[model samples]
Target: MESRDYMNLSTDKAFPKLLNPGESLLMSLKVIKFNKRNKAQERTIALTSTSLLNLKGKKLQRRMDITSLGGITRSKHGDEFVLHSPSEYDYRFGSPLKDQAIQTLCQAFKNLTGRTLYVWESNEISLKDLTTTKSDKKKGLNKMPAPETAINFRGEVPNFNEESKDSRGKRSRTIFAATENPSAALLDDFTILKVLGRGSFGKVMLVRRKDNGQLYAMKSLRKDALLESDQVEHTKTEKLILQHINHPFLVKLEYAFATSTKIYFVMEFMKGGELFYHLREAKRFPEDRARFYAAQVGLGLGHLHEQNIVYRDLKPENVLMDEFGNVYLSDFGMAKMLGENGSTQTFVGTPEYVAPEIISCAGHNITADWWSFGVLIYEMIVGIPPFYDQNVNLMYELIQRGKLKFPVKSPVSDNAKDIITKLLDRDPTRRLGAQGFNEIKNHPFFAPIDWVALEAKRLPTPFTPRITDPLQAENFDREFTDEAPTDSVIPENKLNMILQNQEQFQAFH
Candidate 1:
């Protein structure tokens, strides 16, 4: 394919108009790449390039420095560059000059330590059955793309189902807020106070916004790990779920942002720390204490269920306590919004709390949460899960058997046992609240607790953590918080494994 020289396209809007298939736009740009190195690690320099092309069949061959991008934004509209549309799409080319030009700039982007470089359509449809006017004449719109590839841009296809939620077919409205247009603040906008938690690929940092003095727990994910483990989809799902769900007992995701090597999740910081930390230290909660926590979590889970969501991971570690001891379910890595009639066969969740059906390879639903809730209540009062074991294989065997034998020495109440028994029923269909949470709520075990008052947080909690200051880090393990502060580094891969797959994680925020 060859480039065309006819230039009569409209230039008023940010994108192109109906110029048909063969027209080309002229664009002049400086192509450059960033060879950003892990400052924490000493390594040989790696180069990355991005190419920007002028559709005029001329290549911009200058290796522009990356650091001085001051005029780059201005040049986009300077009688040269053709601005792309807001929604992303592949610009398939007969000759691919636009695609080739863009790819060349990307190829030229190299040397993160220096900047030589690099930086980064609509219509409607006419449903005339062409057989009458077009097919007979053959000179009208018959020359357009084949009907199979005729999906022109006309905004988004509307879903008019009764239970459709937002544009994503969820069962809720306005689930995503300003997340679509995220906060302009960068990682430097916050002052890192201390490390709150750490994962194999990243860490959660307690940070205070320098502008407003607002405190938020930022979960940082390493780009390398995300691509290497093939977890880009999982990461995107977690981010989207956090943006979609809103409830009192659910942890709020304020903002999410991404950089070249890391993606950060800014969240409301829960001061009281992990329920597991409290559970481990306290050894066990009293019946009333356990009841309060369980009831609060029940509301959180119930809210998710109402939204047709399933909280696959419901362990104590993922449930956090605020200063008031009000619990909010966190970590949606395993949580998903299953539509009105959706179910998955994927095995997820903590082993000890995983439902029997999941292990049995039988499809499961919200009932899995009730089973986990039973394990949660048991562990809260008894200080350990029923299926506790050093061996994971043994744990799976026990989980499959689906047995719960309360310890004889423990003082777990009979009412509690009754509720746990109903929840942990091997038969998921017969499980408490398998049909609805009312069965669990109306149980005698929760007879004394007021569900409405509990949700309003009016009922006094059985425990409240002692948090004196915003910078407190005692709630997290010393092993994590004590690790000398890191500068958000990922081990460099010389084999190009992580870098090649980085496309999956682009533009998270």
Candidate 2:
């Protein structure tokens, strides 16, 4: 082959190649040995091209840099080169460049010299001696070494030895025992600094474990409050849900303990603040920043679905941000696992975010989670829910009708609008769930994200909140607690009154 056309060598510049079908070229690489002078001492090795094509200069510049793909560096002795190829170009381990670029150059040497090359490509192998050697030497390379272990594989019979100890162990426990009291265990060990957030049946406190001095959020629920309110089942369900889910993006339940009066759940302390605070204060997230948070929430939802758990609650208030601005799904009070062919019948969830199926009291499953996810996405971008009404019943009716009226002046992209439209489909069957999220990750709006890598948090978030320093937080903490009644001032009797008489407290229920 002509050096100009075959090598595609243009002056001193090198470019990758293209080739016509069935055409091949031989490459004569001068692997010259160098001494102290940086000049060739001796030797040259030749390799035939398996494929070749010349790319236009501009196109070649865009190709991924493969220099780090693994190739020989200068030898310590300076007598020989390291003899390797870029990992991207190589497929087989030691078959040489003729077959694939990654193979060891030693194989090429053996092929050229009509001598055998023995390299331990891996620690173990097996070989059967042929009654006679084959004339094709290339075929001989695919043999086994002295037998250290043998594994026989035949079609139908399954093997028992391959099972893992973990796989063989008892199935993972998905639920914790429900208790009438969780307060004694949680309160006796921690000093309640202040109440962070409170629900009708439970209260989350910013507390420090006295023994370890470790700060935590202690969620305390009076057994009488939960039971008298007929929310015991839901509370138990939340504990079970938290016990089953262990993911980075979801709030972790450190432990659950109870006293005769109340149940207490220890959870991770989120110091950065709340998603609601960010959204309300910032007005709305910029496109890229919103995408980052949305992607993370999608991942957390995906994990929940994989474990058959549905996070019925998906609102900015239910999501907490850590110091690094990582969103963690916090409240799982309404979460439930859909058993095979099972669904939830309760009509529960935040009115603006609940799905039509949920409001209708039709059996609902994980798809309800996606509907709320859509509402959340809209709120993140527009600074308001898509279907908001001052009247709670009207809001549910609007959501049931699946009417999402976007503000004409809103700056959201059409791609996002399209995704939200589909995700909020009244028919749960058509709403975005696991498969739908995959489509979303590929949308042009998120084209820049390395989806697999982003899911792993290998990439950094484009927007992070500016949070108070730990020391400043300490000062804020003191002021924040001053607004609420002192923990000691409530006294046992007054605390019981607040706990048992839900309607009596105007601010609470």
Candidate 3:
């Protein structure tokens, strides 16, 4: 049966009442609504002077007050628009007559609230514009505040002071006032050199600071995509964790700042690139070499667990190496802070490395990272994960089965196999590192590792990359390095539209 049929039957049984009296409809149109899961459903949107109603036939599905409307934005290349609501999740709708629907709604909103609705081309909307009122102006909201000359890390504000200085040691500063272009003001200090990586929502580039000529990796993410996907809170959490934690085996965040359209994270550049790249070239590593990398990663995870932060994502791709082949855990996007003995129900992690508890939705804690660590160690010695399968569902079933097997002719020691079995236990309570990281550190497989010397980085590295120059991209994938490394220019009008939404990223710094 069609999905619309299900909607009709559901609405008929729940809501039989029609529109309220004196609330006449002004415009009714068939539209597609994108729900929280991003699935599209057919519904009728009726716009009135007092409210906007979502309906199926004569049954009401949802009603939004017109007076409470915040803002409206139209997509650049489609008949789609997002209705911004400060008090609830933003509503996304698409219609064949999108222009007419938006025009009629905006007219009604302005007539009722005495505020003009500015339709932005992009999906960005300003909450400041939505929540501000004439009464707020009476409270002196129009005054200009003092410029910030010194660096303040309390709120994670950007280091604008660094950008304000020149080669001559002279300093000039701007207040980042409402009329100024914030993106150009902040990003102009760095010269983009190459594209380091790309993902669905953003890209990472190798950039150089103009003042000291130091190299760094700058990650840029789109604000609209983050909001549409409901990842705003996750992004904020990742920034906070990165800002507070400082360990030798963990990647360090040097700076974080946001523009009207994007957020940027400046991090120390790792010359040797991701461990995954080198692992693929070498196929697999010897037991001793694998132990070296695993020990460092264990220490990194242990440090995070000590701070009550769970590193939910752990895999070869996130393990980065320096020129001397020292590993550092990167990408804390999935990490979260929990209260004492707390567990989270969010289903996240790479499919192959996901823990059994996460798959069953049983709630997970720091022990989940131990499961992924086991998978990483097994893959490092065997050239692939223990339960790896091309079919994701079957692979998950294998993981839940909690079976551990070694190749018949493999050279892996008994100590290695024993540790893997304990860490891969189906019961999180019985996992090797469930009690504390010291259990894993004391395992016989890592007996050769001098824990004290390793943690201090005093021991010599087992391997080193053939790096001839600091600026060379030989260690990184050629596909990313060959691409043009230019930050796209935002139109002046679009920039203004994004500036209005700066309140959403005030803590990005």
Work out the TM-score per prediction. 0.63, 0.58, 0.65
Ranking of all predicted structures according to lDDT, beginning with the best and ending with the worst: 3, 1, 2
Tens digits of per-residue lDDT, candidate 3, 394-504, equal 566689884688987777889999999899998999999999999999899989999999999998887898789867667777778888888755546546545666676
Q: Which stretches of candidate 2 lie over 4 Å from their true place?
A: 1-186, 434-436, 471-482, 485-509
Where does candidate 1 have its weakest 10-residue lDDT segment?
Answer: 169-178
Candidate 1: where are CA atoms >4 Å away? 1-182, 494-498, 507-509
TM-score of 3: 0.65
- Find the candidate with the highest TM-score and give its number: 3
Summarize candidate 2's per-residue lDDT along 167-227 as a digit string, tens digits: 1111111111122232334457777777675554455677788888887877777654454
Backbone-clash count (model 3): 1
The residue-level lDDT of candidate 1 at 129 comes to 15
What TM-score would you give candidate 1 relative to the actual structure? Answer: 0.63
lDDT score of model 3?
Answer: 0.71
lDDT for residue 397 in candidate 3, whole number 0-100: 67
Supply every candidate's count of residue pairs whose N, Cα or C atoms clash at under 3 angstroms. 32, 18, 1
Top lDDT hit: 3
Per-candidate alpha-carbon RMSD to the true structure:
21.7, 26.9, 15.4
